[model samples]
Target: MSDEDIAPGSDVEQEVLDDEPKSILLGIIGQLRKGGDLSRVTLPTFVLEPRSMTERITDFMSHPELINNAPLNTDPVGRFADVVAYFLSGWHIKPKGVKKPYNPVLGEFFRCRWDFEDGSTAYYVCEQVSHHPPVSVYFYANPQNDIWISGHVRPASKFLGNSAATLMRGTHHVQFKRSWPGEEYTVTLPNVYARGILFGSMYLELGDSVVLKCPKNDLVADIDFQTKGFFTGVYNGVKGRIKRESSGEVIYNIAGKWTDSIQFTKASTSEKKTVFNAATAQIHTKVPPAEDAQEEFEARKLWERVTKGITTKNLDYATKEKTAIEDNQRVILKERAAKGVTWQPRFFTGPVDDDWSFGLKE
Candidate 1:
């Protein structure tokens, strides 16, 4: 690829000349056309998000106040209705794009916290527990509210024609405080389907089905994420209903785009209330700067060079640093294996299933 191929005098050329990594994107597209495996492929660093996967998954906990306000509803069904709203709040956190986040190296970790509007705090920690299957374990908690989120998910990526799809296979548990801490809500992640590979206009969606349920309460929230068809279907159409476990008595119907607001209509009175409105919602997107971050554990510090490369539009530097970091990890793993040593996750050491109710009291 050359400047001539970049279409002179257009935004493409201007963007490319301003940032060279914008140029290697053509190469990435070419590789994708040949059905190159994204997991094993070396992605151009310019398209990097400049953050670790650990940090990225914290998008779920960005709206901690929603969880803190769960008790306000008073009724079990109403509270779960609010919980479903809280779950949908963070669906559209990142915009649709072909750009992908760097696969986390083994033992990579991220920790951060958010200061909410009501003066409450939500802290989070994530660990890259496995590399081959690409598993990430995350924990988020607001001690003041006694709410916590814990889960481990292994993401599998594949090339599906014009899109790169990733399936999230793991369930996260949500525990809220009250006299009834015994009942925990279990939530599973939805599949991520991102399109617009061949064309320039790209979009992202959470596809397939996702459910939120409490075993003790026997209440289930069935959510179906509607992905847009080739030309039809809504982009972010999310529709579901909260129903009983035994009789399957539908309590409330949920409908709305995950990026916008989700409404809960009580089955008895048809009373509708918008529990989550993203337009007015406050989202936290700050992280520790590289200088202030610890030497290696922090994402900003670990990928500082790669970030600099992309920010400065130095593709060569970005690729070099990214490769060096990846290579160093490989060598370390090899040496450890030769020495008959095993690597363990710092934050998540036991079975991930334990995380579902890890800190919750029985």
Candidate 2:
């Protein structure tokens, strides 16, 4: 799928259930037990979002403008707040209902660039570094703005009766290359829960807590993404506190819905102001080269037939194409095993102490 296919205002939210039969879905669920891992399970094509997980990581980079001026902020606390705003900005860009992106094959990569209005540009590259316990590693940089972000996401999914939860484990390190070169803001991700997978209307929610901390600045934000409980609470509610790490003194109170607007209130002055409003926030455009221009192992090129089948409402064809790709991967893996060769990623390197890094120099 092209970048525009998944961009904001696309028809990605329109649920297509015509290809998924209830009995088939139930049969698949019958084989799955509570707390079972879904990493190896083959799911229905209709539940796919028509994109690879490697490409999905770009969603977090969609609002680079949020942190563009962070390096220029003299106050350390102000810079910390900018990082928090950028982290919370991406959660609102998602397809409606519960859908998962394609499980990228090992070594599969996606690359794109974002050109800002000021003539500056940012580049993003990601790779499926591991297949068995799927891990995706990515790097994004805006050299002109002295902004750099590198991260990896390992999604471990579990079946929880009527719901499926993806325990997101990873860290994103944001740094200002030129200014405060050694100082970094470390960020964590919220766990994703897909509710009503077995019955009722299936929907997605993010729960648990996320911490954004900077050791050099001694500032931190403890944010909790609250999910709706049975007949209680509300969807997409987020509340947190920005504080001084050394004294544990709260500086600002953060409250708002991630899918809408987020407001921050200063503890000392009781001054409240909206920090990010999803309703009005402009999602900067991302430019990806045409499919024909991509390499053979690039995400869009590898899944072209499958994506075409999905977008054209020919799901049966999509399933056939998807199966062919997976089956071909198995053959390649077996061949590699016979040759005693290991598959290496193109854009990333490691599990170096269980962490991956962008192989190329920034």
Candidate 3:
């Protein structure tokens, strides 16, 4: 191939430069498109309703391990509700006065407190009404002084639609040490949802940031996580909280109900580190830690080639000029080459241009 075809500034180079960015952007979109595969993945649609003790007992048989040492195992829903009732029973809230509906699938419970006196209540104050459920539940306090208790059960669909996913934004910082081993590393980040309740099965967005310093350089990085699952409503709901813009209400929010931290670190490996030149950049001789033999060898070879070429070119140019002065004029011509070589020819003569002054007052 010609030099035009193979060199850095060639047409091929320009074409590659133009297409590289588009190719990378398309590659990223391809990975995000994998979310479409969720169509084949089955997800349970929760139907929340009240159930009796007998029904809770039937459901317990299906998952016996869930209620091995617990009290009340009459029906599926009732058994689960009874378990919840036990936890709440410790509180002074009357069960009948509570009149709240619970959903097992979403792991949530709702109840109304007619009046809670801090004098008798150990957990909360008299003015504060408690509404904590199993996994994800919202409770609002009533300001009116004690007598009537009332609340409603509504689909979480309104609160948990597109808005829930958007409200789930976060950032974290992590440091990497060079002495750290392993190509794959895990940094236990503080749970992003530091203040939300675990609602039923919901989608969560997990993100991370890593800051690294090497020599004099530093950098930042990010990663994304997503998935779905049942919020046990127990300890492991990935709990957190955020303020609601629409209703101006603050509730215990759930960050991640379904997914765990599996594929959390999905970022390019190169961004995790920074590289800089080491001091004592190049060596001339090797004694011990002071100098490197390989660098010395490479430097010596480079200088030898460069000086040798300069000497050889000067000798060749002199020979050419000597032959050119044969018989035409017996003149010594001093000319400069296009490559910046200052050529001075020595002829069978004495002082060339000092004798003839071009009308200049020296």
Tens digits of per-residue lDDT for model 3 on 229-297? 233222222332222334433222223221221111113231221111112111111111122332321
Tens digit of lDDT per residue, candidate 1, span 182-260? Answer: 8689898889865654444455667898999988878999999987664565657788999998899999888887877
Give the range where candidate 1 is weakest over 10 consecutive residues by summed lDDT: 10-19
Ranking by lDDT: 2, 1, 3
Candidate closest to the true structure, highest lDDT: 2
lDDT of 2 by residue, 1-362 (tens): 22232335532233324334656777787898899998888988878888999999998987877898889998998999998999999989998778899999988989999999867899999988888889999999999988999999999999898788999998789999799878999999999997766656566788999999999989999999998776566678899999999999999999999889999999999999898999899999888888679998899999999999988979899999999999999999999999999877777777777677887633
Off by over 4 Å in 3: 1-163, 166-216, 227-362
Candidate with the larger TM-score of 2 and 3: 2
What's the CA error at residue 60 for candidate 2, in Å?
A: 0.5
Each prediction's RMSD to truth: 5.6, 5.1, 38.4
The global Cα lDDT (0 to 1) of model 3 is 0.21
> Where is model 1 more than 4 Å wrong at Cα?
1-37, 71-73, 285-290, 352-362
What's the TM-score of each model vs. the native?
0.85, 0.93, 0.14
